[model samples]
Each structure stands twice: as structure tokens, then as C-alpha cells.
Target chain A: MPEVSFVESLRMTLREEMQKDPLVMLIGEDIGRYGGIFGVTKGLLEEFGPYRVRNTPISESAIIGSALGAAMTGIRTIAEIMYIDFTTCAMDQIVNQVAKIRYMSGGKMKIPLVIRTQCGGGRGNAAQHSQSLEALFFHIPGLKVVMPSTPYDARGLLKASIHDDNPVIFIEHKLLYATKGYVPEEEYIIPLGQAEIKKKGREVTIITFSYMVWKTLRAAQQLEKEGVDVEVVDLRTLYPLDLETILQSVRKTNRALIVHEGCRRNGIGAEIACRIQEEAFDYLDAPVERVAAMDVPIPYSEPLEKAVIPDEEDIIQGVKRVLSRN
Target chain B: MKEDHQIWLELYRMMVKIRRFETLTGELFAAGKIPGFIHLSIGQEASSVGVCSTLRPEDYITTTHRGHGHVIAKGGDVKRMFAELMGRSTGYCKGKGGSMHIADFSLGILGANGVVAGGFPIIVGAGLSIKLRGTDQVAVCFFGDGASNRGPFHEALNMASIWKLPILFVCENNQFASTTSFHYSTSVKSVAQRSIAYGIPGRSVDGNDILEVREAALEAVERARKGEGPTLIENRTYRLRGHFEGDPQRYRTKEEVENFLEKDPIKRFQEFLKNEKILNEEMDRQIWQAIDSELTDAIRFAEKSPYPQPMEALRDLYAEDVDPLFQRSLA
Candidate 1:
């Protein structure tokens, strides 16, 4: 096994998929010559040339709409919307056209497309550049939303998403691009809608994903020293959520603490908490707790931004609060 | 290009077929046979038929909400089109997409979009796909003068020009975008003029004349196939009918509608065919009767077709792994 950064894993997976499938192509802003804003698509232009590795103009709607069209016609396209927040410009293409074309066409057309974008609030990039918007796509039907927490998961899930016969919203955490994880020398694919138990315990279950998974793991380690065994469940996919694993974890632990970087109001954590109570209510010894970003725009000030987003302390406090009730 | 007698007769026949089909559609909508609102292309047949006539079955086209003429002219099966409009299982989209979303990929008919300027970007993609595959096939985007004002129009035109993607941007300047006239909404004298900003060749033609429209389409399609990039064509035409069924004639004066009715593409084509000695009164009557019979058979086929089972709504939502998790609660 070779350890690689999340960005490298993505590039490796893209290279392998494009080599294996002639229909696989890349189209987005600065993805060709500039090697992508985050350098995730570096050196691909040299390998694949400009035809397959296309660098499109700064037109979000056209980028997504063209990707949707190409996917429908006969190709697997990965369109990058540099910042996830910029997706608002192409909302109609993603929500109305790409997401509904399969259902609307009655399965006659398939949009094998992956819209890769980065979202998170750790950096002091302010509100527009930093925000977790998986909840928006998760709310839509006919779309598979995948958020990987590690390099191994990112590479595998992205390969799977590319081959999927449906549109996928593959959201990357801006902060997780440099995170290193062990990826196999051989190719592998982590199926979407599957949860991974990063660390298992018996006292409480901390459910999180993407960057929040790292925070929860750190908090879980601190809790281990204090003799509180906290189980961490990293939801690799948001929609088609791995509810069975979540319910099983909650059943074993008898307490659930949902953590996410998105605002607390109507966030993905809220849905998880609701489902935990609805399906596993009897298994809970205490009410389900949620640790999420404060309901405010990500501030420009570093301290204010840090204060708004969930941290390890918040996850630890949330777990202790749930444990205190029991 | 000089069209022969056979080509002129074929054009006339197609124009008559589209006119009769649209008229019957209006009648069916009034009789409560169709479920949704229908945008009839009563006066825009020449533009659709003429442009489609120049392309092969492998060439692609993206149409607007008012896209019945385009689909029919592009060799779509009349029965399946009627079935789709009637919400039957035998329809092109299995009744899931009613009037605004009919498509036949085998005939290279990309789905009609409900958005005003939706077809622009999709056509760019189709053109891009053609370029990537190293094929000479071209993609045509049929939109209105109103759609030219949209962001996608700018984005698609600029992208297609810089990349030199093989696409034909056909703007059916039918004088109205819904109830608003082009004069009120558009800044330019003609939509084709905007093509200059993107560094593409732009031309305007008499959309009612089938031969003229066909000639212009031939040049553009040939240029696209030669990898000369996209061309903007402004077909100066009008919508004789109201934007949608049940729309009162409050937007435009009745005189304006009557004036456009005088320039009806079908009648003009019939006159041209007559002058060219290709079609006589007897032949015109026979063609009308044949088209009427064909439309009647299509309606009967649609009426006899089955409605999709209610459970079908859940199907086709995903291609694989129908996710029993969501279906369990619904069941």
C-alpha cells in the first residue's frame, strides 16, 4: 500500500479511469493548463492532451449544462465548479436538467456525470468560498451525493461515481485535499452510500463525514484517554444515506451525537438525528445530540470563522453531554 | 443550390403535415384530450422543416418548448409523438415527459427543453462531443429571439466560437417570447447581429420561404461539418397562435396576428410549389387529405395506447440498484 494525499489519489483515479474508458473526459475552468486551482488535475493535460482534458471558460452554467449534454449523448464527464458556492450560477443545470433528465426521459437517457467541487469553512475564505452545501444536493432526487473523508475513499468512490449510470455530486472538502491516507497499489472502488466505522466503541456513537470525520476522530481519541469509548461513523455518502449502519451503531452504543460543519439549521445532521430517534428511539438512553456550525455566514476573521465552525471541542462536549444524560 | 421538383414536393408535403398536426393538436387540447399546455408552431413550419431537411439522421438538434414542428420535421414518428403528447406508455418518453420534453435519440433529436435558452448549451456539448469523436456530424440549437438575451446564449456562443465546435445556432425570431414582443425585450435589430461579438458568421433570412431557409441551413450545416465552427441564423418569422392554449389575444393586436397569418409558411410553400410546376390544386388536395388521414391514425393509436402504471413513476428514477430503502416506506 502506498500512502498519498487526497489530491493525488483523485488524480491517479482519474488517470486510470480515463485510460480504461475512452469516453471519460475532464471539463472545467483552469483544469487543463493551470492544473486546477487546487492542483488536483495537475499534469493531466500533458498525459491526455487538450481534447479529453478540456479547460472551459468561466461559465458555470455552460460548464455543467455541456457536461450534462455530453454525458447524455455518450461520454462520462467530470465538470469542476471551482468553489461549490459558485454552483448557484449553474443551479438550473444541476438541479433541473442533470438531476431530472434520467427520470424525465423515463430511463431513455443516462447522465453519467460527476460534478466535482470543494466545500468547507476551515480557511478564512469567508462565506462564498467556504460552505458545506451537500445538504442542497442531498435534498434533490436522481442525484447521488458523495463526500469522502480520506484519500482512499476519495479515489475509489470517484471511480465508482464516474461509472455510475446516474448523475453524482462528488463534493470534496477544501481542507481534506492535503490529508494523507493509505491507498492500495491496486485499483479499488468504495461503493457509494456505504458508511465506514473509523473507530468502534461502546459508550457513544459520533456520526460525521468529510472534514468533520477528522475532527470527530481527534475528539474520539481525547475521549479514549478519559475512558469514554466513542464510536465514529464516517458517512461516505449523504443521499441514499447509510442509515442501516447508523442505526446499528446507535443501537450498540445507545447514544448518538451527530457532527457536521454545515449550519445546524436544517443541516444533514438534523436529518440523521431525526432518523436515529424515529427508527432507534428505544435503543437510545439519552436524546440525540448534534454539534454543527453556528447558523451564520462564515466570517472573514479567523477566530470568528473558527468559532462558527464545529471543532474537536464541540464534538467532545456534545459526546459528554449525551453521556451525562445517561 | 437549385432544388428539384421532387425536393420541392417533399418540402411542401412536410410543411403541410406539420401545419395539420399542429392544428389537430390545438383541437385536441381544446377537447380535453391532451393533459398539459401545448405551444403550437402553427406559423413556423418552414423554419423547422427547412433546417431539418439539410441534416442527416446522425446530426443532433436541441429544440425549445414549442418544438413539435422541429421533432416532426426531424423524422420523429408521428404516432409516438402523438402518444407522448397524450401521455401514453407507447410515447417517446413513456408519458413521463408530456409536451415540452419529447425526444428520439435514435433520430438524433435531443430532448426539447422547457427553459427558454436551454438548448444553447446542450447543443454546444453535442458539438463538443462531435469534435472529440472526430466526426463531421453537426448539432443544431433551435431557440427564439427571446432566448438570445439569456446568459446561456452568451456563454454557449462564446465557448462554441473559441473552441470552434460544429454547431448551428438557429434563432427562430418569431416576433414574440410568450406575450412579450422581441422589440420590447431585445436590444438588437436582429438576433444574428449578436453573433459578431463571438466572431461567428451571422445571417438573417425570410423564414416563411422554405427554399430560402433551406439554402441558408445548407450553407451553415456544411460550414459546421467542415470544422468552421458555429453560425447564427435569424429566421424572421412569427407565431400565429397565442403562446399557449387558452391565452387570450390581449398581448398583440388581432391585426398583427392576421398579418402573420397572411405570411403562413404552408400557404406560401404551396404557392411556391405551384409556381415551380411541382404541385397543382389536385395534388395539394390529395396531400392535405393524406396528411389528415395520417394525423387521424396517429390520434387513434395514441387513444388506444395504455397509460403507464402508477408504479412506473418510481421506476427509471435510477438505472441500477432501485434502492429498496426508499421504496419500502412508499410501499
Candidate 2:
């Protein structure tokens, strides 16, 4: 199998889905002839026709609302918000309509809708376009959150999310689009709510997901060089989090450090920390340390951005602190 | 609009069904058997029945908070609708959607929306799908005078007009949006007047007269099916009941309600049918008996149905394919 970039994988998944299901459709701003801001949807309008790959007006509420309506009426729709920050404009539709419809309707309704948006601050997109909001979605009960860290997982998960019966909030990292991983050209699926253990270790376990997964893995490699042998766990799905896997890892290592790109205050790390403290506290040798981006907006300046966001060195330091505490 | 014997008789049957359904629903709400707020389509039944009667079974409809009458006219199952209001597992939305949001997709009654003007954009999307699939299906959106001001309503109508989407926007101007009279709320004298801005044909009809409402809705739907874009039908009617079950009509007068009731759609239909010699006592009795039994049975089914399990609440928020989904993906 040839290595495929994450962006290419997403494009292929969309192509395959569009070809298979006549009801499958795409809608977003500049998604038609413009091929999307990221070019992941290049040539879709020409290949599938404009109707199937529509370019919607710049109305997030309408974009999300229309997608909800279309999905309710038998069209399997994938609506894209250009950036994660803009989803705030459509919070009511996303949280109330999309998240609550199935439960509020007693499961008689199916919203086969996928809302794909990008998150990250490395490019100095600053506060508006850079914050990770997976925790906010994870707080909602009905929505499933997918944040893939690799090209293989991104492609496989996008295909799976498209066909899933529920509404999926798929978050793509701005930094990972160009990243490449070995992906089969043919059909595949990466199951949601399953964590992948990136590097096996007997020392403290590092529970992380999304763009921070790679950061922690690099940190783990450095930790191993220092004889710490830190285990790095990547949680592929955030909503129905694989608590069992995380618990098992914690039981084995008896020490842990949770990491996320989202700000630390009331972030996903807090929830994961609370869960660990509850389920595996007796087995742990030290309190769980969390390595998250400091609780603030991502800055425009490179050094300021680095200070606010967590990197491999920060993950390495977090591991050392957890090990010393043990 | 004067109707012949047959049309009057049909109108009487529909109006009675709507009136009886709402009366029963109001009673259920008072009895605490129904959860969530109820927006009755009581006095405005003519608008729902009239326009819905014009639609083919395959043609689509999107409705508003006050949606029961429209659903009934579009052939939704009465028992399932009731069951849904009671939060039973057998309801139209499997007990998820209550009074304000009941729907039966098989009958082409897309779910009634809770948000003001929320149905417009969705109706446009549905219309787009219809056009794309090369189906002659025309989608009708029955909203209220209040929804005319919503941004989505304007966006949807403009897009529909430009694309010539097969849609009929039926604005049931029932005078008040929860006690806020249209006169005080809307800037335009007539809701249909707004259509000129979108470049779609516009018309106003006596919503109290089912025949008039039917004729207008039908003409607009026909035009849409002919690939002529959307039409705005402002059916001027009045709200017979308070906005929801518990609203005290401190905003309106008893004289106003009485005045609207004198021209009640059901009574009007009955008079028209009797004068035209189409209504017999036997036909009246049969229609009442049929609707009554349906209502009674539907209530029973809803009462007997189970409440949803707590765990099932986790399902259906997102579409899924081969992935194990949130549990595994997060793991």
C-alpha cells in the first residue's frame, strides 16, 4: 500500500461515498467550484454535478439547519463549517436540533449527517480559527466526536462517519492535513470509541487524542531514551470514550498524563482526569498530570503560540513530573 | 370561494377531523397525558386541510409548531401521532418528538419544526433533492405570519425562486403568533406582499374558507411542479385557542374569539354542504364516528406504549458506517 496524505484520504472517502449512494450529498461555503478552502473536495462538483456537491451561502445556521432538514427528509448530507470557530454561529442548530433530534424524537429519526470542521493554532490563525472544541461536543450526550491524528485513521473514519446513523462532529487538525500514513487504496474502516496504543511502554501511560497524540508519541520516544518507557494512548473517538482501554493502561502503569489541544480549563482532559480518579485511583501510584495547551487563546506570534500550545517537550516534561511524583 | 356539493362535503369531513383531533389533544394536555407544549391548529384547520388536500401523496410538506391538522390532512396515523405526544415508544418519532414535532415521513409529512421559520430552509433543501433526483415532487412549507420575518424564510424563498425549486410557501397568517398579532408584528400590510421581493407569485386567501385556501395552494403547487419556482400563499385566518395549552388570552378579547368562531371553517363547510344538498345526516354521523374511533384508539395506543429506555438516548445523533463509532473511536 502506498502512503497517502490525510487530505487525499478524505477526498477518496468522499469520492467513494458519493459514487455508492445516490442520496449522499455535500454542502458548504465555497465547496463547489472552489473545491473547498483545503482542496479536499477538488473536482467533486464537476464529477458528481453541482447539485450533489453544492456550494451553500455563508450562513452557518442555515448550512447546519438545511443539512438537518435534508437528512431528516431522506438525503444523506455532509455539511462542512469552514472552521471550527465559526460553528459558534450555529450552536443552536448543532446542539439543539442535530444533537437532540434522535433522543427527543425517541430514536424514530436518523440524522445521517457529518459536520466536518478544522481546528488548530500552529499557523497563528489566532483565537477565532484555532481553538479545539472537542470537549464542548463531548459534553453533549447524543453527538459522537471524531478527531483523527493520522492519515489512515482520518480516511477510514471519514468513510465510517459518513455512513453512520447518528450525527458526527468530525474535527480535523490544520497541521495534520499534509501528514502522510500508510493507507490501503481499497475499502476500510477505523472503528469509533476505540483507542490505539501508539508505543508500548511499562512506565507512566499518556492518554491523548487528535493532534496532541503525535506530540505525546514523540515525547514517549524521548522518555524511552531516558529509560522511562512512557506509554502513549491515542483515543480516536471522544464521546463514547473507550474508558475500558484507558483504565487498563492506567492499571498497568499506575501513573498517567492526559493531554489535549483544547485549553486546560474545563477541557476534555478534566473529564478524563475525573474518570481516572474515579475508576483507577486505587491502582495509581501518583495523581494524574495533564499536559494541555495553557488555558488561553492561541496567539499570532510563533513563540507566544508555542508557549500557549503544548508541544513534544511539554509532553516530555509532563511525563517526567508524573514519574517523579510516583 | 364557493364550492360545489362534493367539495363542500369533503371540506366538512376534513375540518371536523381537525377540530375533533385538536379538542381531544387539548383535553389530553389538560389531563397531563401529553408532555411538552401543544400548539393547536384549531381555528386554523381550514388552512392545513385545504392545502394538504391539494397535495399528491408523493408530494412533500413541512409544517410548523401548530402541525397536527396538516399531518392529519396529509394522511399521518392518528394513533402513532398520539402515542408520540405521550412519549411512548410507538409514536411517530418513536416517542421522541411530542405534540409540537410529530411527523410521519411515509405520508410525506416531514417533521413539524419547533423553531420559528426553521422549516423553510429544510423545505428548500428537500425541494433541491426533489429537483436533483428528477422527481416531480413539489414541497409545501406551511408556516405562520410570524415566520415571514425570519432570515431562513427569506433565504429559502430567494434560493427557491432563483433555482425554480418546486416549493409552495404557505404562510398561515392566523393573526397572532402566540398573542402577538400580525398587525403589530409585521411591517407589510399583507404577508403575501413580501413575495414580490423574491420575484415569486404571491396571493392571499380566506384561510377560514377551505375551498379558497385549497384553490390558492393548488395553483401555487401546480406552478412549482411546472418548474416556475416558489409561490407565497398568505392564508388569512385566526387562532381559536391560546398559543399553547396554558396561555390566558389576556392579549385578545372574548369578542374577537367569538367573532372568528362565527365564521368557523367547520361551520362554514357544514352550511355550504347542507345548502348544496351534499351533506346527509348519515354522512355526518359516519364521519364523526370514524374520526372519533381513530382518536380514541390512537390515545389508547399511546397510553399503552412504553417510555424509551435511558440508554437509547445515546443513539442517532450522528450518521454511522463501518466504524465502531464513539465508544471505540474515543477509546
Candidate 3:
């Protein structure tokens, strides 16, 4: 077993995948000689050469559109948008073209494409750079959105997404890139849409994903000492949500709390909470609760940014609120 | 003649076929047989047939909303295309994609994009794929003058130029982008001249002349095959029909359309074929008859084809098995 940082795990997987399959190519801004802005694709260009590790111009639409074209035409592509906020520049290509091409073509086209981007509010990067937009992509029917919380999850889920013969939006958190976790040296793939129960308990179920998973896990540990048992379920994939796992956890605990780093309004929590109520309403001993970022533009100030996004305290309070409903 | 008489007649036949297909499509839409809207390249047959004449079946092309001529020229099956237009299950996209999104991957025709300049970037990817695969397959992107104003067009051109991707950007400057005239909407006087900004060779051609379009496309396609890079070609033509069927067309006058009717590509190619002795009235009549019968059978096939079940909408949305969550949410 090897303990690797989230960014290292991603780089290792990309290198291994590129070595295994020549068709697997990386394209984005500064992904080649400059590596990536987050250093996730560092040294990959030197390893794979220029053609496979392409450095693209600041053309988001072209970056995504070319990825779509190349993927369908027998080249698997990993298109990197430097930031999730910038994805709006190429919204038509991502939403109209990449997402719908397979279905629109009657399943005649195979889009082995991965759009890797990062989003969160902890970086103090302000409104344009720090907002989480997984909800927008999740709303698209044809795309698969995966947001991993740990190095282990990131490595395994990325491998599955790249090989999945469909378009995948592989979302990463900027804050979690340096976080280290145990990863086995042997190759193993974590299937998308499969939720992992990070910590199991019986009192309350805390369901979250991406960076929120870490905060929820810590809250669960503290709640254990406070005589309140808590369960944590990390939903690695957002679109084809692991409803079964979520429902099972909620059914077992008879209480549910959804947490995410995105805005509370129409965020990932809204959909997850709705699904829980729809599926496990009878099993729930209390109403479902959600802890999410405030519905405001992420400010550049550190205190304001921290206050806007959900934290461990928010998750802890959300758990107490759900438990108090009984 | 360097080219055979049969090749000349074949090009004329393709142009006529596109002309007939577009005319029939317009008629059917007016007759209320077709569902959804359609954009026709009624007067741009020479640009499509001429450029496509230089491409192999394995080469790639990404077209625009006004893409029927390009698709037909690129060897798309008329029966499946008509079936798709009629929203039949036997169509190219199983009725999911209509006239604006028809695609035939077997013939290397990437789907026609519904967006104005959506195909530019996608065709760049196709060219990159060709280079990676180590093949000489060039990718042609067919767009309108209006599309040149889009961000993707600029981005795609810059990328294709730097990478030296095997791409042919055929701009069908039909003088209009829907209601807005190309002259008013485009900043440049000619779309071809803008190519110098991206360091690519470009030229404008008389889009009504099939020989001229074909000769320019031949040289460009050769450059792409030899890994030289992309070329921008502005085909100066006119949209004989309105942007879409049933358009009020208040933007342009009837006299304006009638003026371009004299310069119709199909008619011009027919005259050239007649002068070259490659075709006569009888041969032209036979070609039309053959195409007409084929279109008639396609209509019959589409009419007989079953409409997809409502639940079938959920199918093919994903390459993987339909997620239970998807079904639950829809339910």
C-alpha cells in the first residue's frame, strides 16, 4: 500500500492509462509543458510526448468541442477546463454538443471523454473562480458527473470514467488535491455511481461528496464521543446517484442529513434530500436536513469565504437538528 | 480533359440530387408531412458537391444547420435522412435527431450541429484524431458566414492552425445568418480574408461554379492530406430559400431571391454538363427520375416505419444500461 496525495494519485493514473492506451490523450490549457494549474497533470507531457499531452490555447469552447470530436472519432480524450467557473465560456459545447452527441446520434457515437475540472470556495478565489457548479452538469441527462473526496477514490473513479464508453464530468476539489490517503499499489477501479459508506453507524446518516465528505467524516468522529452515532456516505458520482446506498443508510439510521460545498438553493443537496424523502420517507424518524454553502457569490475574504461554504460545525449542527426533529 | 466525363456527370448528379432533395424536403414540410423545422441549402449545391467530391468516404466532415446539401454530398443515405426528417424509427438517428442533427459515422459524417458554429471545434478534434491515428483522413467543416462571427470559429481556427491539423473550413457565405445579412453581421468583407489572421491560406470561390469549387477543394484537401494544415474557403453563394421552411422572409425581398435563381448551382452545372457533352436532356431526365423514385421509396419506407414508444425516449440517453435513477426521476 502507498499513501499518495490526491494530485499524485490522479497523475499516476493518467500516466498509467496513457501508457496502456495510446488513444488516451490529454488536452487543455498548460497541461503539457506547464503541467496543470493544480499540478494534477505534472510531468505527464515529458512522459507521454507532445501529441498525447497537448497544450491548448485559452479557447474553452474549442477545447471541449475538439474533445467531443476526438472521442467519437476513435480517440479517447481528457479535456481539462482550468476552472469550473470558466466552463460557462464553453457551456454550449459542454451542454449542447458533448452531453447530447451520443444520445442525439442514436448511440452510434461512443464518447470516451473526460472533462476534468475543479471547484470549491476555500481558495478565496472569489465568485468567478470558486463557485461549485456540479448541479448544472448533473441537470444534464446525458453526462456522468463524478466528484471524488479522497486520493483513493480519485484514482479509482478516474480510471473507471476514462474507460466508461460515455462522456464523464470528473470533478475535483482544489482544496483536496494535497490531501493524502492510502492507495494500494495494485490497479483497482471504483465504479461510478457507487457510494462508499466512509463510516457506518445507526443514529444519523450524513450523506455528502467531494470535499464535504471530509468535513462530514470529522463531524461523525466528534459525534461518536458526544454519544451520538453518525453514518457517513460519500456519493462519488452525482448524476446516476447511488440512491440504493443512500436509501439504505437513511433507512438504517432513520434520519438523514445532506451536505455539500455548493450553494444550498437547488444544489446537490436538494436532489439528494428529495430522493431520500421519496424513497425512505417511512423509515425516517426525523425530517431530512441539509448543510450547504450560502446562496451568495463566494467572497474573496477568507472569513467570508469560510462562512459561506459548509464546514464541520455546520455538519455537526445539521446532524443535531435532524436528530432533534424526533 | 484531365478528369473523366463520367466524374463530371457524377458531380452534376450529386448537385441535382441535393437540389431535388432540398426541394422535396421543403415541399413535404409545407405539406405538413415533416415534424420540427428544417434549414435547407437550396442554392448551395455546388459548394457541397464540389467540396465533398474531393473527400474519401473515410474522411470526416462536421456540418451546420443548413447541412442537407453537405450531408447528401458526403454520401449520406437519402432514405435514412428522409426517414429522420419524418421522425421515423428507421432514420439515421432512430428519429431522435432531426434534419439539423443527422449523422452517418460509417461514412465519417459527424452529426450536423444545431448551433451556429458548433462544428468548427469538433472538426478540429477530428483532424487531431486523424493525425494521432496516423491516417491521411482529412476533416472538412461546413459552416455559414454567420458562423464565422462565433467564438468557437476563432478558437477552432487558431487551434487548427497551431497544431497544423488536417482540416478544410468551407464557409458557405450565403449572404445571410438567418434574418441578418452576412454583410451586416460579419466584420470582414469576406470570410476567406479572415483566414490570414490564423496564418492559413484562404481564397474565395464562385460557389455557383462546380468546377471552381471542386478545384479549390482538391488543392486544399491535398494540402491537408500532406499534413500542411487547414485552409479557409469562402464559397460566395446565396440562400435561394428562406433560412428555414415557413420563414416569413421579411428580411430579404422576393426579387433578391429571384436574382440568385439565375445563378443556381444545379442549373449552372447542368448547362456545363450539356456543353461538355457529358449529359443531355434525356440523361438529366433519367437522373431526376432515378432520384425521384428513390425519394418516393424513402417516403414510403418512413411512412411504414413505426413511431418509437414513449419510453424509448429514456433509452439511448446513455451508452450504459439506463440508470434506475434516471427512470425513477422521469417517473
Q: Using DockQ as the measure, which candidate wins?
A: 3
Candidate 3 structure quality by residue, lDDT tens digits, B1-331:
4467878888988988888898899989999989889898989999999999999999999999999888899999998998899888899999999998999999999989999999998999998899888999999999999999999999999999999999999999999999899878878899999999999999999998989999999999999999999999999999988888989999988889998999988888888778978888898899999988888888788888887777668767777647435435432
lDDT of 1: 0.90
Off by over 4 Å in 1: B1-3, B321-331
Worst 10 residues of 3 chain A by lDDT: A101-110
Interface RMSD of each: 1.5, 2.9, 1.2
TM-score of predicted structure 3: 0.98
Ranking by DockQ: 3, 1, 2
Candidate 2 docking classification = acceptable
Q: Which regions of candidate 2 are displaced past 4 Å?
A: B1-4, B280-286, B300-331
Q: Which lDDT tens digits does candidate 2 get at residues B1-331?
A: 4456666667678788889989998999999888778988888988988898888998888888889888998988888888888887777876657876777677887778888887787788788778768888889999999998777777778777877889999999988877798989999999999999989899999998888998998898888888878898989998989989899989999998999889888888877776766776787889899989978987887788898776554453333322233332211
How displaced is residue A73 in candidate 2, in Å? Answer: 3.4
lDDT of 3 by residue, A130-229 (tens): 9899999998888999999999999999999999888899999999999999988889999988999999899998889999988888888888889999
How far off is model 2, as Cα RMSD? 3.2
Q: Check candidate 1 and list the clashing pairs.
A: none
Better of 2 and 3 by lDDT: 3
